[model samples]
Target: MINRYGPYKRYKQVFGVTSHSNPDKEHTVVITDKGEWQCSCPAWIFHTPRKPCKHIQEAMKDQVVQAFTPKPITPKVEKVLNRFAAIEV
Candidate 1:
């Protein structure tokens, strides 16, 4: 289970949030300047092997969506050129 406190700006290019399943204890979820996510939870520390925790996931939900969503690609049109044009001296 996971609880989200929403992301808050920590510094330039960094964000953080508080989360915990149990009401007694809370952990900090941090999004680094390099866009990497981390959590200070036992599950994240001892298990999952560096995988994004629920806290981190919740904090970065918008980022994840934007990263996975594909953008529209514009088609490029080729311009036709004369093959027999004389070369400039």
Candidate 2:
């Protein structure tokens, strides 16, 4: 499987996609931020509603979906929590 996020691997914001068959008469694919996606091969050249092709499928399999999702928090709320903890009756 080829990595979509190749040259940009060192960085943390981009990904790339490699053709499943080096762009032939039957298949076409493009790596994009939206995810490894497919181009409509020769059809793309003709101009059609391009969709994710098979090459993207292969690359996706090798993709490392990061799970370090962060949730938003407010500073005011944190301050209130700290004050409440300090209250000793």
Candidate 3:
């Protein structure tokens, strides 16, 4: 099974991501403040030094998509400048 941890906001400017195969296991990937990625999984620690693990790849994909997606623009309501002008009293 797979689990996703975050597109979590860190400090102010940095974003973090973590994921694992199961909730009981250690984090598979952690994207740090300096934009460096770390994975605690055995494959990362032993085999893949120059390449990112699957968890890191997934998280980075999410972050990249989110960054480019446009935010919804809310329409502004115009208020009457002279609401009392038409009042008889």
Candidate 4:
């Protein structure tokens, strides 16, 4: 059920983030087909590289998003989580 949402793992993920300027307004953050995080907010619309808007930053920290999206794609690397075989110490 890794793709319960659809064939694509992260293409349909979305989150509603409340704007800091106006709590009444909520922003829409989504995952692109290429696994990039995007936000429907003014700050993100007008920014350079390495400058993710507050909404995008906040959404990425969420547990739900964490489950779907892995930390920004790093090439040729893996994190160890568990040991499956016995090894001599």
Identify the leading candidate in terms of TM-score: 4
For model 1, residues 27-72, the per-residue Cα lDDT tens digits are: 5555544566655566766564478877667666744433332222
Could you arrange the candidates by TM-score from highest to lowest? 4, 1, 3, 2
TM-scores, all candidates, are 0.44, 0.31, 0.41, 0.55
- Superior by TM-score: candidate 3 or candidate 4: 4
Candidate 3: lDDT of 75?
Answer: 20
Model 2 steric clash pairs: 4-16, 5-16, 38-52, 38-53
Q: What is the lDDT of candidate 3?
A: 0.40
Residue 68 CA displacement from its true place in model 1, Å = 24
Candidate 3 TM-score, true structure as reference: 0.41
Per residue, candidate 3 scores C-alpha lDDT tens digits across 1-89 of 32333333321111223334455543334454556665554565566334687755665666555434322221210011122123212
Name the lDDT value of residue 47 in candidate 2.
Answer: 39
Q: Give stretches of model 2 more than 4 Å off.
A: 3-30, 33-47, 65-89
Most lDDT-accurate candidate: 4
Per-candidate RMSD, Å: 20.9, 19.1, 19.9, 15.4
Higher-ranked by lDDT: 1 or 4? 4
**Model 4: pairs clashing at backbone N, Cα or C within 3 Å:** none
Model 2 residue 76 CA deviation in Å: 52
Error of 3 at 33 (Å): 3.0
Q: Which regions of candidate 4 fall more than 4 Å away from where they truly are? A: 1-10, 64-89
Candidate 4 lDDT over 1-89, as tens digits, reads 11112122334454556777787666656665667666666676556653678887777676254345333321211110011011101
lDDT of 2: 0.36
